[model samples]
Target: MVKEALGFNILRAKVVTFKYQTVENMSVVKEKIIQEIESIQDEEMLNNIHHVLQNIYSKKSIIILNDEQKVKIAQAEKDYLEGRFYTTDTLFEEIING
Candidate 1:
C-alpha cells in the first residue's frame, strides 16, 4: 500500500545486512598489539611507547603478605563460610552499646 509513492515497491522487498569483526579474548588482543609493536621501526616511537608503559607500571602498588597473614585471611574466609562471622548490624550494635 504506497500512498505517496516516495520509494516503495509493493511487489518487491529487499533486506540488507553487515558483518562486524570481533575479538575473542584479551590474549588475542594482546598478541595483536605485540605484533604491531614488533613491526614498528621508528626508534622515537618505540622509546615513547616504552616510557608510557614504564610510567603505567610504576604507578601500580603491589602488596606482598607474609605466610602468617595469608593463613589468617584464609581462616577468616573459612569462618565466614561456616557462619562464624557476625553481621554488620550486630557489630554496629556492639560498637554503639560499648
Candidate 2:
C-alpha cells in the first residue's frame, strides 16, 4: 500500500507500535523538511551540487580524481571528528589561496 501510494522503491513504512492519532505529526515533519530545504538553498547547496555535476560531466574536469583530493577530504573530516579543525583564519586563507 505504501509503495504504491508513495512510488518509492527505496523506502518502506516502519511498523508503528502506536498509531498516529492526527495529521499534526505528518504536517510537522513536512514543514520541518521544507524549512531545512529552504535553509540549504540559502546556504548554496544547489550551487555546490551543480558544481559537482558540472565537474563530473565536463571533459575538461577531472575524469580520474587523485588520491590527494580523497585524502584531503578524509583528513578534514577526521580533524572535525577529533575537534582539531582549523580556525576560520586558516579556512579563509585556504579559500583565498585556492
TM-scores vs. true structure, each candidate: 0.36, 0.25
Residue 58 shift from truth in candidate 2, angstroms = 8.1
List the candidate 2 regions with Cα displacement exceeding 4 Å.
Answer: 1-64, 89-98
**CA lDDT of 51 in candidate 2?**
70
Best by TM-score: 1
lDDT of 1 by residue, 1-98 (tens): 36545345432232221111233456679999999999999998898788778767897644556689999999999999999989999999999998
lDDT of 1 at 35: 100
Error of 1 at 67 (Å): 50
lDDT of each residue in 1-98, candidate 2, tens digit only? 98676855433333231234346677898899778667774456666656777888887764444689889889989999999978899999999999
13, model 1: CA deviation in Å? 41
Clashes of 1: 0
Cα miss at 91, model 1 (Å)?
55
